[model samples]
Target: MASQWHSLVSQKIFLARNLLGQLENSNSVPAKEALLQGTIELGLRARKLVLIMIARMYQHQHSQPDSLEALGELIGTHSPEIAELNQLASDGRSWWNHLEQLERHQGNPPMARKTVSSENVIAVAADTGPDRSKQALETTLGAMKHFIDILEDRHSEW
Candidate 1:
């Protein structure tokens, strides 16, 4: 279960970075359009996975009929061992929520911050906001991966 969360985070972060890379090398409008749509959608899906995992981790399972019962069943049989996983779930949920809010801004912002004159072609890509967002997303995902690893490694305890 933990590994599942980590893998989802890594995939989404990778997509975001790839999109940022495409933007950096954007030479045509068609390519730019494709990357933008792909990256944002992938990011949203990844964010959704984080939410699902967290919901499964700590939410009490009750035998209510219909969809809510199905959700409970997906978490599997709960035990005292699950208590340790709650902290990881809480942290992951907080980070994912922040990422979702950041994503609501829509398409990537312009990368050229200092380049005023187009003739010089002096566009600096280092200060790009998209890159910062990518890095932040990756960092959060990496944290999630680490947490998952810690649990999976201690499978005996779980």
Candidate 2:
């Protein structure tokens, strides 16, 4: 089980990296959008996998934490990188939530009319712009690299 989670973490990081590369080279708006979406999904997966890896490592040294975030706090003691990665993870998650909100608002006419004000619509539009997507991709890549480093160091200790 531990090995499987480890493999998943590596795989997700690779996928997220590949997606960001593709996003960078993409010329069409649709292609970029698709790649950005994939990158965010893989980023989230990588974050979860790293959290699980930390939890697994903690199991041997101490009792398991109640949640992934708590496990991350414990691991943060070993490396400040974990706390940095948590901030990056939070940014990536908010980016995903913004995209979801835009999609949901656009898809539901009644809900948009009843709930989405002009200011909210403008916010959603801003969230869907390429600038934030590029920033999110860069953040994801940094987080992935840091996460892999932590995992590798942990593995090497064993």
Candidate 3:
């Protein structure tokens, strides 16, 4: 069972890395759209990975966490390193939420402010653009690499 969990983690890491690479190289609209969706997918994968790590390290139980917040509760004070990874996962989750909200609202401003239909959603999206996505991916990839190193160090214990 432990080996199975490890294999699953490894596969997710590979897929996340591949998506990051594709995102870095692509600039077309359709490609960027696909990659942004991929970011959301990878964010979920990251959450699952963190949950698995937390369960194995502390809880000794195998069950899906209800949400990232629930995972946070599971991780409470157990491991600072895992907490850092969870924070990164939260950031990844936010990227998708932010993008989705922007889409749903058609780039409208705050309610207190005048709502302008002339507002360009594309420009708003550009503000949170590929550059931001690239940085996020780089950060996630680095964290995953660190995670692998930590796992390798504890391989015998597992």
Candidate 4:
């Protein structure tokens, strides 16, 4: 499991680096366009994956508080990048997201939203999941924001 998570983290780092490269190169329009579009998708996906890892980390995470805390801080610093990527993806939805989504799904069944049929307003307890993950989410968001800054900053060489 640790190795699996390590792989994911490594891949995320690679993706982040690749995004920066693509943004800075500006040599090929089509590739740049694809990178501009893919960045958001990767950000969203990475956020989801990191949340899962963090969620697992939360279980008895007291033992490794320092590492977990560092992870949270890193994620916080990275969030803006994710948001910007999202904005870029939404700016036009171009053709990249579609193509990537299709490739990812690869004919898998589309995810469906299950409707609740509860008629009783039996006061449902407040959400546990969101509250638990809120900090981690904020941390990841911060990281994304920083990444966005790096991606958007003007490069003299470009």
Candidate 4 lDDT over residue span 104-141, tens digit each:
55335545644556774455564332211223323343
Which residue runs of candidate 3 sit more than 4 Å off their true CA positions?
A: 24-27, 67-131
Clashes of each: 0, 0, 0, 22
Tens digit of per-residue lDDT, candidate 3, span 1-158? 44456567667766766777787588798997687667546545654565575556554676566555666567564566455555554564543333334333433553453345766333342243333366765555566656655764564375
TM-score, predicted candidate 1 vs. hidden true structure:
0.43
For all candidates in order, the CA lDDT equals 0.52, 0.59, 0.56, 0.44
Q: State residue 37's C-alpha deviation in candidate 1, in Å.
A: 3.5
lDDT of 1: 0.52
Decreasing TM-score order of the candidates: 3, 2, 1, 4
Candidate 2 lDDT by residue in tens digits, 1-158: 45666777778877877878877678999988788767766665666556666666555344455444576577664555455544544663643344334345434444223367666565433233333456656754575656567666766577
What is the alpha-carbon lDDT of model 2 when measured against the actual structure?
0.59
Q: Which residue pairs in candidate 2 collide?
A: none
Candidate 3 accuracy as lDDT: 0.56
Model 1 lDDT tens row, 1-158:
54555566567767766776667588998877677656666766665554454443444333222222343455543633334434333553444444444464454564445546668776455532333344565565555456455544554254
Q: Tell me the RMSD of model 2 versus the true structure.
A: 6.9
User: Model 4: runs farther than 4 Å from truth?
Assistant: 59-158
